[model samples]
Target: MKRTNEKIAEQFKTFQILDEEGKVVNEEAMPKLSDDELKELMTRMVYTRILDQRSIALNRQGRLGFYAPTAGQEASQLGSQFALEKEDFILPGYRDVPQLIWHGLPLYKAFLFSRGHYIGNQFPDGVNALSPQIIIGAQYVQTAGVAMGMQKRGQKSVAITYTGDGGTSQGDFYEGMNFAGAFNSPAIFIVQNNRFAISTPVEKQTAADTLAQKAVAAGIEGVQVDGMDVLAVYTVTKEARERAVNGEGPTLIEMLTYRYGPHTMAGDDPTRYRSEELDNEWEKKDPLVRFRKFLEEKGIWSEDEENAVIERAKDEIKAAIKEADNTPKQKVTDLIGNMYETLPANLNEQMEEYKAKESK
Candidate 1:
């Protein structure tokens, strides 16, 4: 008999709705979305790309703090996010700020988050998301707990989380999947396999043929999708969410994608590890270009319309960064206060000391 992971790997072929040129490759897999909805998807992808570009500039100018570039993975980020309802819980990794913003986080707050402001961690009323997790793979376990809570409360919502290829190697990743599987929790796990976990290539991170096949170990549904195709990501995510809410348990989706920049805005360099030849190859499969082509073929999108969206996004991003800059400097006391409902004695003493120092 064949080994289990190999069987699972053979079953989990990469799914695609659109080819590299944005032409439909699988008509049967096309989602039932309206023309307006298709346009909306393109708008989000374009907006995210602009945001990524602006963020890189901000980081260089010292106007922003930590940032992970989302330039090439626009479809993977925005497409999966577009499939969820507002009531659903989002447990995102540090790079997933775009999803949180679209899910109701104010754009200004996202700027604040990257700036390390304490207020950035606070979610507004009715926003069902946690601040982006800085620790890799921690959100996976947290998502399991949040999904379990929703399951127990009989809420018709699912909890979804995303991590990069590097995150899949963490112990927490497997533990979260196992717990969610055992309890039949309503969770959707997405691994954005962008070929690198920082400087480490994904192949070095695991022995499995594909990240999706790891789902077999937990006895859950698994799939690989063309992450550069927005429609494909949206369709697969929607199906996974539906299954989760219906109590069919969790699904692990591996997005075959790439990031077009350094792992972070910090001192790390991508050129050292990734080759220009490889970069050019992925550039041809750029998500925005592919999706825009598809929308153009449908006669629902034009250059003028896309330009208008880009201008609007620039305006929004400018205002948000201004707001973030106007925010009062975060105090040490503020961090401590947000850390606990009731401060422990030692923390209380430190908070009082910081308050006194702040007052002076």
Candidate 2:
């Protein structure tokens, strides 16, 4: 029997396990995560929180370029990344440092990248992932194409593409979804619905009741999960990837999360639109705090251990910032050289003219 809109809506209400007070509301359905795994998740969550805060500070001090803070969205980011296989490709948006960190990107490398160092583009040898995509919805198309290529090769890997609510408005989003559906490509389009695209709220961004519903038009299944619940995000993403690998086509997952910080280090004034009270309300539901409490209740976390982890993460971030700052600046000629097989006559002449001016 086909389900009605009300029935589907009731079934789709965000999947949640851990409650705000650290209690497992749906303990039976929760994954059998070991004590060690819980500790690891808590540590990663704390590390990400510290890194996000440090990045904001670095931006303010002019040490790094404009950055989007991932403060309140660590659970969704890290949990989704952790659920993937090492061979699976991840296409992360600008606000997904936690995922990159969990994927073994060093703190120094990420910091170097944030500081606009060229070496940041050079992933560790053998790491197939691309640098974070800043052009919003561009990664969606690229990821879909990559997934199609993998399918042709009979590779069992899946490609996970992350984007925001605002990105859903782009034509490329629908195009990528359509291609993935038509080809039955192994890809998962994860929309981290943080409710705002810069200053624009989700209400103004689209008329759709839920981003997940858009997947129906693309001929794929869609699921809405509570992005703040790490376990729920992990489970849903894992299931989606499994389906994709089995030739069930792509899945669109809308992770309902909230970003507590400003959109970027640049001219964004979140305070202009969002109130302090709302920020405080979200803070009470902070993923890190909730997860920490859950771990504590499970006897996997303690104040001393948490404090030690925080101190270590702070030291690591400070060292990475220092190393990134110390790296040599990129040469002016390298920029034009890296982009083309050979510089055209006009570009060559322009470069020479600039060099000559500098020499004078």
Candidate 3:
């Protein structure tokens, strides 16, 4: 055969409704959101970034542990989660704590979870979020099963899972996406392609051209969006949720974004593998800066408004920290009590022995 190009142009272009300067690129595809609604979206994005900043600082100060920073990925995470209904379920990865909080996980509980406390997994009634998954790509399979269960119960809601570019390489990713397509499960998969799976560049992870196209083999609709553009991500996710609940089956979304910091607070360094030029380039397309520009132009946002939002988020974080600190620490007894429906005599005795020693 002669050297020739295959039919690949159809999926090469990235789908983005908003541009870097906060202008809507496609008017027809623009979401019909009001001024207040738009401000609310920007507020959440700002809040998440601030939260990340504060939490990372806390971790550095030895007050917290095990955090995956979400600084540059606010648009992809918050935008998609904002599109979901309250009844919808979420299966988030370590970096999706912001989305988990939006879905009802309290900020303090998130902090507790980061600190390795069991109470961190606890949530008040009516909250439909799951504990953050540290194991990569596991949420995909879990989401598929949850969606199937919802259908069996005749519920009208859907289940959404998030992963990264590296997660697409996991077998669980394929299994989950394929199961959803085959069974018509109400599951939406969000792949935040932040260009690096930890310190490894995404190009080294796969040669599939785009992470969105990974869904094609599963017979699902896949689209790539500007993950830095909040409007574009929200639009795509909202459409996908509607399609899922309307019995149209699954959709895969690849959000093109970047992570400004390390993969985790523990043992990674961005500067070790990435360059200042690349970081500066991505900094220009920051989700918060672009959205703020648009809202300021629309006369719906101002320096005062932004500062107020920041103050509000900081206050909330402070209150959450206080609440978390005041919470009764998880004891040795809870470990045995929560492990089984009926406690075995030997384990119960051991738990009581430890409890007695602690009381003394």
Models 1 onward score TM values of 0.97, 0.94, 0.96
Q: Rank the candidates by lDDT, best first.
A: 1, 3, 2
Per-residue lDDT over 1-360 for candidate 3, one digit per residue giving the tens place of the 0 to 100 score: 111212342564687877889887888988888888899999999999999999999889888889999999999999999898999999999999999898888899999999878999987787787888998999999999999998889888999999998898899999999999999989999999988887788979976677887887899988999999999999999999989888999999999999889999997978988999999999999999999988988999999988998999999999998888898887887777888998789997898898898799
Quote model 3's TM-score: 0.96
Query: Total backbone clashes of model 3?
Result: 0
Worst 10 residues of 2 by lDDT: 1-10
User: Each candidate's lDDT (Cα)?
Assistant: 0.93, 0.84, 0.89
For model 3, what is the C-alpha lDDT against the true structure? 0.89
Best by lDDT, which number?
Answer: 1
Query: Model 2's lDDT to the true fold?
Result: 0.84
Q: How many clashing pairs in candidate 2?
A: 0
In the range 1-360, model 1's lDDT, one tens digit per residue, is 348657767898999999999999999999999999999989988988899999999999999999999888989999999999989999999999999988999999999899999888888999999999999999999999999999999999999999999999999999999999999999999999999898998879887889998998999999999999999999999999999999999999999999998899889889999999999999999999998889999899999999999999999999999999899999898889988999999999999999999999
lDDT of 2 by residue, 281-307 (tens): 788888988888887777778999989
lDDT head-to-head 2 vs 3, winner: 3
RMSD of each: 1.5, 2.4, 1.8
